[model samples]
Target: MVADFDTIDININVGPQHPSTHGVFRMVLTVDGELVRDLDAVVGYLHRGAEKLLENQDYRQGIGIQDRTEYLAQFPAEQSYVMAAEKLGGFVVPERAEYVRVICVELNRIASHFMFMGAYGTDVGVFGTSFIYGFRERERVYRFFEELTGERMMYSYFRVGGLAWEVMDGFEEKARALLQELKRGINDINGLLTRNEIFIARTRHVGEISAERAIEYGLSGPVLRSTGVRWDVRKDEPYSVYDRFDFDVPVGEFGDCYDRYMVRLEEMRQAVRIVEQALDQMPKSGPIMPEKMPRMLRLPAGEVYVPVESARGEYGVYLVSRGGNHPWRCRVKSPCFTNLQALREMTVGEYVADSVVILGSIDLVLSEVDR
Candidate 1:
């Protein structure tokens, strides 16, 4: 005979839908009343076989695939891909081009974080106000990018030796103007939710993870930094001209959803700091692409891995060449995919309602996760 009070845990499904799950992500949750006992994250719904596609494309052609793979943070993906080719080919990027690359990538980081703030606010139930605040600044940044690359999103502007072409006229002036607008946007988001009691109560201590646990889970970007790990690829690894600029890597003490939010909030300020420095240091005139460039690019037989600090985390690309126009093998170390591994850990033991908040804290781009 069974005890009268005994009850079995119930399974609840969240997403595979656009709005509820953030991007075609589905999680099966085991719940006992309002508390979650366990979770199983379902991915690969948005997989587009980016690695397989890269094999058939030449170094330059593969840039588009990189853009699609990490759609939200396209420049870093493009940078990693091109850097890998540059590594194998031994092409020297111009000083001016390097500075420009730094400026563009940093601005993209801010825009990507703005995206997080908007979506995160909605996940936390702040609704349209937060979303509007985020997109308002983000769209401004996008318009600036569109003016430069002629495409708001899928910008394959970064090339193997340098950029596809020189930046448009008055690039510096427009970027400076955009930075001032972004500062106000960041402040708006901070005012809207940072001190709000409802926001704090919902996020402060919920989904807490230890630094050790985070490292063990292989988390990176904001998710890892939230747990008080003060590591950033731009700072620690110091790729490109990042070593020339000065900026602090933000970290959190509690490793909760709130800490993750704060870390990204501070990062926007740091990004603006880096861009201002780059503008002052950039060369006035120089070749964007290396001279003596062959009409066709064929990397020597070798293997190389280049990692760049994307908005999400370390976006690394491993490329192998067999002395050909096309790469023999291409693999991406997407931070989103690695970070998603720990979602179950963060979600379990929290309230069922908090699952959405926890998942949003990871700030996932499912295409990257599924790539």
Candidate 2:
């Protein structure tokens, strides 16, 4: 009844700039009818040689470029770069600054996840409704960031020792109000998609990666956790003042597209908890930077890597200092790149259209992946 396996196999190229591939990404698919037999992802179209650029600039000047790599969650990228430099320079951030950084980063995490939710829904054919809901909350958060750092999206607010600037009065009140609004917005999203029959049918069993295989592939963030691994860089590594906060890492059991979606959904609630705790515990008075800061920060010769729990996964920075104002070398271990490696593995047995849905579940930022 069925044709010979070789007779139906056909090769198709997806995209290096199409919308569904999520940003300047290409994939070569070997398919038999609609079923994908193989997949090869091509990344780097968004590459701008970010690591080489960082090596050429002064430590302070590199923050702007770090933003370009992860436009959605620039605060964490800034944090990773600055924290690495701080370790080399022996700098201490003020108590207030640490609290501020955590709050801002968590808010940015919420924003990034919103971007994923919107995009993922579209991939599943919900079209503009989910995207509209997602951007509504994101725009609200972006407005707050604009007031705080003077940039809505690409904020270089984190500095080598602390924050770029201090918060204005009434900051706590404003953040609390935002938190309340976020709770309602998340509830609306859950009601719309969590139990939707079509959504479940399309995603429940698609793109499964076993826990062992996920770990073998070196995956992190929701993609890895969707396989039931309870690893989180924040809880396990406890960088910055994350240890002071009480939060739970959400894990998934199915290792499927639906589980990945649910994991990030629950993670948003955890982020809200972290932000609330930070506001309650943050000190009111302290200098953000160390006393009498030097005009130019020169680091001692050394190498250090700082790993932070970014919205996507373990976004890490490796810095090599040469006792100069500029770093000898800088490398970003982007979670998108590591996670994207598992794409072919996830898509091999799925339908071609489902391949797009699986890619959306990974929530990649191509600039970071290609960098």
Candidate 3:
């Protein structure tokens, strides 16, 4: 016998400002008592017309805008933008510069996953403890970034030819220390939420989607991996010096919320491994950029798409240059936007409370979503 839900169904608006939505995101939920019957993910409140803005800026300056899109993992974003520009200009990055870029990007990936751990812990009610522990490791990484890039956040340190400048002296030693500290931090966070009965009960078997469905929906990063797909842009497509590193790609089974959490945790450890290898192999000294680059980079007419593995997922930039100083069109394929498409499927039939945890499990940065 089918119970008529129409009599009890009610619509509730859940964001544009709700703390749990993670950003200025909103969703209108049609609920049958405590369960979500349907959901409409409302986006664009945070949109700043990122692609259009990129079209206007010169190639060198587009990186600043890219950082704002995925504020959590700026290095990968910068890498995609610069690599696209480099592809268009026929530029070759030096071997030493490639090694430094890899180390910078891998460290950035770990910091980004730390953010996911802290924020997701709050979604599961472990709040302050996870936030503090996560930030402790993230701060250490950021301090190292500040030493190299001169800014804590939106450091536009990557260039079309290579990097802004050579990395700081004693970079190898500092990198080794960062890895050791991060490993300890990871274990601490693991102890806090990985085995907690409350967290496990709330997250396990919740927000599950199969590997086939995840691929159908264009999911990537830990979200896709949680479904047991071992696809990682770094491994499959090998950007920068990723091909040289020896690290494992973490995948999950069941694609549940718990799997997503666990996958990200394991991925952090792998990122640390990659960073250690990079530091060891990196040449002690070399030019960060190619010799005597142009004051104003003017590119020949061409179009190129450069894809990089960001902490979020596949961060790609498609560049079209028509014999101009600025790109004729610059399009960014943001992972958050692609993954958010599955929100309705994940939320339906789940309790209203579980919806928040599921959203957090996706680990979004909304600026990227609405970009």
C-alpha lDDT values of all predictions = 0.92, 0.91, 0.91
lDDT of candidate 1 over 3-72, digit per residue (tens):
3787789998887884958789999999988889999999999998899999998888999999999988
Model 2: worst 10 consecutive residues (lDDT sum): 1-10
Cα shift from native, residue 248, model 3 (Å)? 0.8
Clashes of each: 0, 0, 0
Candidate numbers sorted by lDDT from highest down? 1, 2, 3
TM-scores, each model vs. reference = 0.98, 0.98, 0.98
Which parts of model 1 are misplaced by more than 4 Å?
1-4
TM-score of 3: 0.98
Candidate 2 on 25-141: residue-level lDDT in tens? 999999988889999999878889999999999998999989999998888999999999998888988889999999999999998998888888899988888899988988889
Candidate 1 local distance difference test against the native: 0.92
Candidate 2: where are CA atoms >4 Å away?
1-6
Cα RMSD for candidates in order? 1.9, 1.2, 1.3
